[model samples]
Target: MSRQFAILGLGYFGSTVARELKRHQNQILGVDRDESRVDALSDMLDHAVIADLTDEKALAELSLETYDAVVIDVDGNLEASVICTLHVKELGAKEIWAKAHSDAHYKLLKRLGADRVIYPEYDAGIRVAESLNYHAMVDFIRLGERQFIVEVETTERLVDNCKSVAKLAIDRDSLFLVAIKRGEEVIQNPSNDTTLQAGDNLVLMGDLDALREIGKQI
Candidate 1:
């Protein structure tokens, strides 16, 4: 199903998001105070308009309440971002996602009823650090409270020692295998007897510490 989205900024972050969402066949309304920025994305988005998002009257004209969600990314101007968030919330937008440049900005956005607060730079830094620290871990998602779902690649030593899923000596109480990704194929909830291969990607869910331990061994 196609959903409607309103992106209230045309900077790098907001423009990138609008383009990707439009690519997914979603109806996107791209708004910006800059005429050039709005024009650049006009072809890709369902609607592109230049408006002062801080002005509640201008925002009201956009009919933001009708969209499935609204994304506010005017972090370049903190005051404008805050004002836009407040107006969007008052307009009864179903979901509001705002970008925060600092801890204080995040708190304020949350208080203003933004459904999600994004820290793009900070999050990217963490992802980079994790990839560097865990050589075998390809990627991971934090599920809060120290739990994580991590994807780690199998090593030659690991495959040679454990020929099948059940043969791997991991603590089942703390860690559980979710799936095996071999090249283009994915085996979900693989059987205990499923064969293991070097270079295969294993999807595991467990505590962060336990996942880190497996990463070290693999």
Candidate 2:
């Protein structure tokens, strides 16, 4: 069976997630308070409902078991968010993820039995700060646990075809080379002959300090 998901919001973050889920071939149900939002997402989602899910009776009308996962993205209204979360839990949805605008909201969602409460805006701000403040970090992605996958732009050698990444590692500690994205093509597990180019982005796996050093040597 295909994956199924429900997103209860029509704003930027909510709509983006709804569309992205469709790209992965999931059956998406997008719910919003505005009919305009429902119409806009109609082409992208399997179903679109313009209903205030905070209304307990309206929420109870939908079969919660039909959706595998449900996400609450209504960040503007705290009362609505709390009510909807409680309603979904009461309706027996197995997995529930909600967005929280503040610490109090996050705690409320937890008490209402939401499985996960995401602070999207807060997380984005942190990432933006890291990218801007640390010039060394070209790209950062958390890879389970505390490890991170990062792409760092090297400052030293603009480009290098001289030695393989392994050879370069012999002296300057080696970070795993996940892939080399050059132009549109991505070269996975690049060989020793692969020359690091200035514009070429290296997808690497390692810790922050090592990545910082690699960042300085590009």
Candidate 3:
């Protein structure tokens, strides 16, 4: 089903989100105080408008409350971002996701009722560090404290003598082999008898430390 979204800033981050949502066939309203920014994404979005989001009256006129969700990304200006979040919350927006540049901004957005706060740069940096630290780990998602879902690629060394899932000796108590991705195919809930292939990607869910240990072995 298609959902409605209002992106209150047409900067890099905001425009990226708007485009991706539009790609998924969602109704997107791209808005920005800068005429050029709004114009840049006019053709891609369902509606692109030039509006000063810092003005509560302007936001109210957009009927933002009617949209399924609103994304505010005016982090280039701290005050403007906070104001937009506050106004959107006050206007009864169903869900609000705001981008924050700092910890202080994150707290302020949370206090103003933003449903989620994104630290794009901070998150990207962490992912890069994790990839660098764990050479075999292609990607990972943090589920909670010390828990993660990780995608690690099989190495020649790891798959040389071990040719089946059973030979890996995965600790069921701490690690689970969720799936095996070989080219375009995915083997879900792979049994111990499942054959292993070099260069295949393994999706695993377990404690972060356990996942790290597995990455080292791979």
Candidate 4:
């Protein structure tokens, strides 16, 4: 179902979210202190208005409580962002999502009743670091602090080339062969006797360090 959302900042991050939401046909009200910012998004949003989000009177006029969600995406000035989030929370927004520039900012946003706080820079850094650390890994998704789902490519020269799944000596407790992708075909929970091709892509889920060890052997 399409929902209503109020985006309280129309800078890069806020505008990006607004456009993506609009693509899904959600009703969006784009708000910003700068007229130009609001104007830039006016063509796509359900409503675009220039308003001081920190001003309670200005915010009250928008009927923010009626929207399904409120997004706080202004990070240029942390104080203003905090105040805007506070006002949104106080006005009883159903769901409050805010972006934080730093750890201190994240803590403040949480204490101010923000339902969710996003630290994009920090989250992206972790993904990049994981990719760099595991040279053989093509993709990584963290399921827990020590658990992950990773994709690793296979080559003809690997130690386990042409070996059946059961011969890999993988620790089933810490590792699972979720699926194997060879070109357009996907084999899920492949049989123990199923053999791996030279160029097959392995999709695994398990302990991160254990998976890294398996990557080294295969």
Ranking by TM-score: 3, 1, 2, 4
Clashes of each: 0, 5, 0, 0
lDDT of 2 by residue, 119-160 (tens): 977888878887887665676888765567887654445455
Query: In model 3, which regions exceed 4 Å deviation?
Result: none
Off by more than 4 A, model 2: 143-146, 154-156, 160-164, 167-174
TM-score, one value per model: 0.94, 0.83, 0.96, 0.83
CA lDDT, every prediction?
A: 0.91, 0.79, 0.90, 0.88
Between candidates 2 and 3, the TM-score winner: 3
**Best-performing candidate as measured by lDDT:** 1
Worst 10 residues of 1 by lDDT: 208-217
Task: Estimate candidate 4's alpha-carbon lDDT, on a 0 to 1 scale.
Answer: 0.88
Candidate 2: C-alpha lDDT = 0.79
Task: Return whichever of 3 and 4 wins on lDDT.
Answer: 3
lDDT by residue for model 3 (1-218), tens: 99999999988899999989999999999889999898878889888889898998889999998999999999479999998899999999999999999989889999988999999889999999988988888888999999899998999988986799998857789999999999999999999999899879999999877776676678
lDDT of 1 by residue, 66-139 (tens): 99999999947778899999999999899999999988888989998999999987898888898889878788
In model 2, the worst 10-residue window by lDDT is: 165-174
TM-score of 1: 0.94
